[model samples]
Target: MIISSAEIDSAVVALAPVMRRTPVVASRVLSEQLSADVWLKCENLQRTGSFKPRGAYLRISRLDDEQRSRGVVAASAGNHAQGVAWSATQLGIASRVYMPVGASIPKISATRSYGAEVILQGETVDEALTAAHAHAEESGAVLIHPFDHPDIVAGQATVGTEIIEQVPDVDAIVVPLGGGGLLAGIAAAAAVHRPDTRVIGVQAAGAAAWPGSLQAGEPTPVGTMDTMADGIAVARPGAVPFAHVSELVDDVVTVSEEAISTALLLMVERAKLVVEPAGAAAVAAVMSGQVDVSGRVCVVLSGGNIDPLLLTHVTTHGLSAAGRYLTVTATISDSPGGLMEFLALLRDLGASVVDVTHSRVAGSLRLGEVQVTVSAETRGPDHQSEVREALAQAGFLRS
Candidate 1:
């Protein structure tokens, strides 16, 4: 279905009372780094910790009395589930949500707390969605498909309206792309209001489907999906969003896992924003030199409902990727003070030790030698080099 300017305008008015006009804040750190004035559309602070609720509410609100009476059913790994559940509750409609068996406990709990009857049904989101469709058919409930309908797209367009209003001179807008509702919706608003403004879509390289689909002139599905950024790890592009994206979007780009982690790290450390990996995708594009354009750029921070465990893991990975964390192994004399002296060398080089392990009886160790492994924190790539140089010069680092 075609999503027009009028439809989006109507949705903006309808959603204003229900949805947040999330902040568009200037990022001084990002501005100093990239050759552009950068602003973040912090939808991570939106209701339900993402932009999902905006579309969910609009889609549910459009249902007729008969459809509303039948209630609604949905499937999601996390953010979308909470969004649909919260939207349904706001409208006083009964809702059921099917989530993957391995979906994060926090997300499942959040979905349930939003008043959804949570069902653990399958091993993956696709499988859970199959169960949701079955439930919808059997129970006569409305299926709230994430990002596939005009209402969802129009609902997501409200973000675009906010952007145009917030950053009137924005040269480009970057969005995290999954099913493409948010990207297409923003592109729609940009098309109608600021035709000169560029709208770029960023996807996880491991699970990207847009470049191929755009080339094929239709929605295309990928054979396999793998990514830590669960929010935008969509294997297929939705048909409805594809219609608008193929025509309106300026460019679609993919960023690597390392880039995403680093971007998330930067957002947390530099901008002080708790953004998920998917939400950091656009920033990853800028940091990794994937997005070539520059001006008053606005990167949409899509969601923030990350599991604490994941946050810990991703933070470590991010630090490592950014050269702020390091792991090294070396052979030292098997004497009692050997390990302590080795650690002293690291301390002298300004590396803060995280953990250290020593073994005297390794297969590769010489009779009077010990194998020692250490993980340390550094300032950046240069500091890492300095530490390695000092270790090697001291004859403590072997090959």
Candidate 2:
């Protein structure tokens, strides 16, 4: 089933009333660093805080009268669940979504708020999908797959079509990939309108399935996936998306956990964009230099539906990864002046203390001696090393 530009064009026309024409913004910092024109496709600002609704809404809207009456069901890491639920509500059809047991709290809540019966099941999206399939079979609800359907792909392809229209001179597009709906859709659009425009897929290193699947020339399933970017943690490549991606996508690459966190931090600090880890994956790829890119490159920020707690953790991790945060242990005297002197040392080193813990009874501590653990904020990597070196020289550093 070839998904032609005509189908995508029709999807664009059909979805115009519902979907936002997301913006394309230039990344000054990234352009300066990479020495190329870098742009960001802010799909993170799309309805439901993601690009999922494009596919989900289009897929659900296409169902016949009987299917609509019976309702829709789906499984997602988080974003797609909300998309389907919101779309179902808009169409006045019932909806149910199954999300992984540890899915982001905000995403789950948003899905329910969109009027879906939410069930928390399984440890991964693939496992949740199993339950969704069973529900569709037993309850007769039409299964609205997160990907893996012609209509879904066609819907997502609107993003690509928009990208071409938004950046007529774009040289490359980097996308966050899970089951490949977004990547494949964009690749198809590029193939039709701008064949020479490179389409790259970025995946969380722990959950990447495309590299293996593309090598095999078929949809391939992996045994396990572990990543903080739960939104892109799928175990297998969907067959429908695989066909388009395998044939059309220029490259598929993975980004490390640290790199993803760093990218998320950069987006928050530099771009003022609140994006989930999966949403930052493409930027991670670019920042980590995993994918060779130059010229006018654009990366899609796919979603922004992240739990606040997760955002805190990712930001802290990103700080650590970027060497802007540090934790150090030092043995100080179990005396009043001990903490004051130790803090003074940190102040002199220009490290702003974030937190401090003093322990009197820790492993092998002498009777008069105490242990102090300090977490500090620093300027950058070199400053972190300088702080450590200063502490070590003062004979307070442990190790």
Candidate 3:
């Protein structure tokens, strides 16, 4: 079914009272870095820490009493489940969410807190979806898809409405793509309101389908998924979203794991906003030089429900990418004097030791030799080089 501007506008109007009109934040750092006017659509701060609530609420509110009484069931990796659960609770409807066993703890807990019966099943979203669909059929529960629905596309289009009003004369918009609900909806609205503005979709490099699928003139599943952006890690694009995206989206770009992690860190440290790897993929494309932006650009921060453990790793990875964190292994004499010398060398190079481990029996170290693996905080990449040089001068072999 085709999604029109009127339907999208009505959805926005319907959701106005329930969903937040999240902030459009200007980032000087990102603007200077990208050499373009940069404003972030911070939907990461939306009601369910995601823009999913807009579509979920709009979809749920439209259900008739009979359908609502039957309740709703959905499958999700995390964010969509929370969106559906929260929207159902707001509508006073019974809801059950099927999520992958590997879903983040924060998302699982949050969905349960929203008053939805949570069911953990399978290892991946596709598996959970299979189980959810079967359960829905058996229990007569309404199945609410995470994406690929007309109401959902219409609901997601509201984001474009807000963006046009919030950032007039926007030259381009970059959205992270999964099943393409958000991209399709935004593209449709942008085509109507800002036809000249370029709309680009960003996907995880490991899970990208837009480029190949558009070329093939049909949905084509990726061979494998490898990136950290689980939210956009769809093997294949949705039929409904793909139809709109093929026409309205200008370009589709892919970003790497490193770029996504860096973007997430930048959101937290530089922009003071928390964004998940999936939500930060658009920014990742820009930061990784995968996309060119010469004019005013808006990057949508789609969600912010990253696992705490993953957040720690992303922070370290990002810092390492920016040359702010350094890890090195040095082999020295097994004697206690070797550690003293290594510490002195690091201090001389102005490296602050964050973590250090010494092993004498793990490998082929000589009877008097030791392996010291050290993680240090450095001023920059130059300081890291200085530390390496100092260690070498102190008779420590780089491992």
> Each model's RMSD to truth, in Å?
1.1, 1.0, 1.4
lDDT rank order: 1, 2, 3
Tens-digit per-residue lDDT, 1-399, candidate 2? 559889989899999999999999999988888898999999999999999999999998888998888989999988999999999999899999999898888888899999999999998888899999999999999999998999999999999999999999899999999998999899999999999999999999898888888998888887678789988888898888998988898889999999999999999999999999999999999999987777899999999998999999999999999999999989998888989999999998899999999898898798999999999999999999999998888889767
Clashing residue pairs, candidate 3?
Answer: 334-368
Total clashing pairs in model 2: 0
lDDT of 1: 0.92
lDDT of 3 by residue, 174-278 (tens): 999998999999998898889998999999988887789999998888777777888888878889998899888999999888788888888999899988999
Worst 10 residues of 2 by lDDT: 217-226
Off by over 4 Å in 2: none
Weakest 10 consecutive residues of candidate 3 by summed lDDT:
390-399
Q: Native-vs-model 3 lDDT?
A: 0.89
Query: Which stretches of candidate 1 lie above 4 Å from their native place?
Result: none
Runs of candidate 3 exceeding 4 Å displacement: none
Clashing pairs in 2: none
TM-score of each: 0.98, 0.98, 0.97
Which residue pairs come into collision in candidate 1? none
